[model samples]
Target chain A: MKKFAELLENLIYSPSTNKKIDLLEGYFKSNNTLENGYALSVLSSNYKMKFIRVSEIKSLMHSKFDKTLFELSYDYVGDLAETISLFWKSNMDIANSKKLPLLSEFIKNCENKPKKKMYDYLFNLLDLSNPTQRWAIIKILSGGLRIGVSEKTVKKALSKYGNKELEKIEKIWHGLNHPYNNLFDWLDNKKPEPIIDNFKTFHPMMLSNPIDEKKDFQILDHKDFVAEWKWDGIRVQIIISNDKVVLFSRNGDDITESFPDITFFSKKNVVIDGELLVGKNCQPSSFNDLQQRLNRKKVSEKIIDEFPAFIKAYDILFFREKRSSKFEFFR
Target chain B: MNILDSRLNIKPLNIFIDPQHPVEKAIISHAHADHAKSGHDKVLATKETIDIMKIRYGENCAKSFQVINYGESLKINDVDITLYPAGHILGSAQILINFKGQKTLVTGDYKTVDDKISTPFELIKCNTLVSEATFGLPIFRHPNANEEIKKIITSLNKNPQSTHLIGCYALGKAQRVINLLRDSGYKETIFIHGALEKICRYYKNSNIKLGNLEKISNLKDFDFKNNIVIAPPSALKDRWSRRFKNKISSQASGWLSIKQRVKQNQIEIPLVISDHCDWNELTKTITNTRAEKVLLTHGNEEALVYWCKQKGIDAFPLSIHGMKEKVEK
Candidate 1:
């Protein structure tokens, strides 16, 4: 009668628009006999939708049905684990490729072994007429390919991300579970603090007793000796005034879209403090080559020049609206 | 066996903090304050060693301790016990017991891969193992703890204003070298310890991935240079690394005897790495858990009970982290 919840509510109003959903391609009839694996596992278990078409679950595996609600909807479509397939591979990459779309008609009607496993994916069939029987339970329940749905579970399924009195957004969504853009401006309340502060705390990071025997920059050069070029990685700060920019890491919170190209000085209200560095032609690059750009909340322009990051400047603390000195912070 | 010896005989063994012991109970297998000690009155750990014993003992130590998470199952008067995870640190388990049908696992210090702090070791069959010779001689294993912290993160990519510290263990060696530099693929920015800063902010507030992190216990505004610091194996020697004289320190336990934590924690090198469990995962958990019987305790338990009875099994070197005057075999 052509109505599996009006074709999964018209494929959930476009979550992956058309990557070949083919509902039954030009209306059913592929050697028509009408069985359709218990209405395609009850329209893929009441709309979690992913019926990657294998000739309609193989003509309901040739009728004579009642397979105990198709073996409990094949363990509810083999529960896509690994954090629900990385929240559907970050809001829908729509997978189906590690080869299984019909392994020669699912190796002769699903063997018997593998009574139940779950995570490392591999079931071997209670038989749905094999088309890599549901992408081999989503590649053994999301073990590889850091995909989908987690920006902190889409910020608790978007009840408007958050803000106001929160016990620290449940302690910053308990160590930040994905969702970004200053976590929707700190769960919607407007994130601010962390203009910048990373007090070196302690290390040989300042030791040099060799500017090659102090060549007259006198009195320690008015105690100036501000040479610079230590640049390893991770010092962070970018403030941007009234129109609000906020990203701070010298022990403050807000990280503005996991370093969206350190907001390349967001229209500069100036607080500056440098060294995020992930370089290429101009030297210094290795915490495994600037860890191919960290924690991303979309920094693509082809990963911003194949991971091109830079900060270098020494210190500023803020300019126009004023507040400078570690003595007008070096130059 | 009558539902397994009335569950070991009603809370059977004792041994945990021990006070002329009569099952005052202290089961612990991993949480390392040298196997979680906190004036116990009762404890039976494993919710990841009661979450590293409520971050190194307190919150009335999980309110007189009683967790049991990783693969739960317990019964004292009949001693069946359970609790496996033991990738070492962060509820680091490995207790396993049985008693009558005799099982006995223990290994409060373990590691069968998966370091970047916790979760990866579970293959424990057991007949009696106990383990932990810290890196039990035979030139002490360890090399890939994410390729030795990717050689201090590829030397902060050729020295981006260098500051690196590293010396860990304010509890589970500085949140497992900040989850092995946030899972060996450094998201950079890391600086913990006010006793490893609030148990690494409650294990990164328990989503547990240890990357893109931060916490140098706010040093106010001393300005040390190109930041990385992780501190504590007792502040890597004094005046807080002499107030950052181009700071570098490093130790990151697994007791850096890499011919001395690269010249005693001056560590221009040394990420040799160690979340315990070495010498081929204590000789492959005494040869794939067909465990004939062995005991060997922490660090140098007489060179792992003389190398697990020179490999013929049936060994014994229990000192429980030795020292405090209790050595003799």
Candidate 2:
């Protein structure tokens, strides 16, 4: 936890991309694989267990410390966890205890606990941890790390440490679970790559790059190029396999729960990359209309009726359990 | 007693301490641009400050100059005045005003932690204490200087193909960073921007042993890998910094303690090396003075004022002209 907190602090302070990668790489090199995997999950905000909420943490702090001072410090610091971490006071003996739990152990303890048990566990954890560790713990429990690191940057660091391509990690990222022992084993070459049988898993999408008109036009041939309408809606990939269908955003986050209307597709076992948009009678609505149905955990009937979502498919990467070749792309 | 008359002045005697505008009789605190301005009629400060002022502004910075050493007493208009070490920069002094046994200490900018370059701070008992609250918040507990300096050494060791460009204020912060590097046993020749050459020379002339320094403009080749370059904060992002092959932008300031500030400045390495006191040091100094009233000046004065009120000390923010905004120190 101390090492993870230091890595988060360094990432927050370092604005340079290369330096952040260096910090993350050094952390991966020094820590154990299980702890590093959990730390990476926390950094990328992919952890499934949220042990405590922000309001509960605030109420717990108010119960222990003076209300007015805590409020004042909160206002000054402009961050709840940081203010509490700096202002929290605990018994010296508890804080100096040598039996501190590791990052993986802490996460394992918090999994599947009752709310009351979780609160007591967090109280004990806060007492036993230093300010930095307390901060990391609170941030992890709150489910928002906001430490200026993107998921891609974490993958880049992993690639640097494991001497693999970033695309390879991103290709298999969404298929893995927390405390990914198999993933680390694969990275360390101690075991074979994990066979992901879940065909609903996300595949890394190829992003488009801007072309310079003056320089790029000199070497290009217009006859060989095909231009498609650039949609302003969000980029999504619809993966339909066997009996399950999933929608992934650009970073491979599963947004299948939000766009239920787009799940009605032919069962051809295919992966289609397209722009998720809202439309009526084949006329696409404004991008603002599509924004009304984004990021919803449970979509209501009225919202689905008002903003009916559909995908404007651009390319089919896979069909009938076979990868589409480049010849099929320009067909 | 009037403490404000168009500028920060003492009534009945008419002495201005670090007044922003030009004044007839001015008691300059330090050679920082905001505190020690030129065009004063008669300027009184330590000899090193006067020399710095002459270097910054021309020799005609003031009509006449009076040099005063630390702890020396001088009588002006029946008011006994003395200077104490402020520990902010070279020759920085805290003015101690004594009139009819009513004492008020004006600390322009000070830090309790002793940086080897400046004279250490001394606590003076006074009736009212005027302090600079640059880092007057509980969250701003600065780490040790040696620890912060070790970060740079570690980075240099880790990335041997990159040049570490540290952005700092030229006067106090630049010299202090150089001195810290030397103290940390960094024997390489530290490169500096052209703007820092004069002030660094001033620091060197004042008997501060800053190891070998070479100006960035003098170097013919651009092979500064694994080297350290000190430049003004503004030059860190400008075209002047593009000369280095792979430069890592870092900043040395108290504001870097805040994550938002570091992100806003795009600082790669944030070294929290401050010239002013942190929250604990500020509160400690104020309490040790045993002053009946406190007047807060500059950065985060409201927080410090609230802190003082909680401790039953009569405190309020002092709004002085040209001192409202914080200059990069």
User: What is candidate 1's lDDT per residue for B1-329, written digit by digit as tens?
Assistant: 22212112223453342112223566666655544556667777766566656666665753366767888877767667777787766777776777677787766666787764567788777777766665564435555677667777776775666576777766666777777677777775776656777677777786666665555556566565666778776676766666665555556655453322244334554565676676667777678887887777545565556556667878876664222332111
Model 1 alpha-carbon drift over 4 Å, by segment: A1-73, A76-331, B1-10, B14-24, B29-51, B54-85, B88-91, B96-101, B104-112, B116-124, B127-187, B190-196, B201-329
lDDT of 1 at A44: 23
lDDT of 1 by residue, A70-146 (tens): 33323323322211211111111222222332321222212322423311123222222122223333322222212
TM-score of chain B of each: 0.37, 0.97
* Best DockQ among the predictions, by candidate number: 2
C-alpha positional error of residue B82 in candidate 1 after TM-score superposition, expressed in Å: 12
Q: Each model's C-alpha lDDT? A: 0.51, 0.84
How close is every model to the real structure, measured as TM-score? 0.26, 0.88
**Model 2: colliding residue pairs:** none
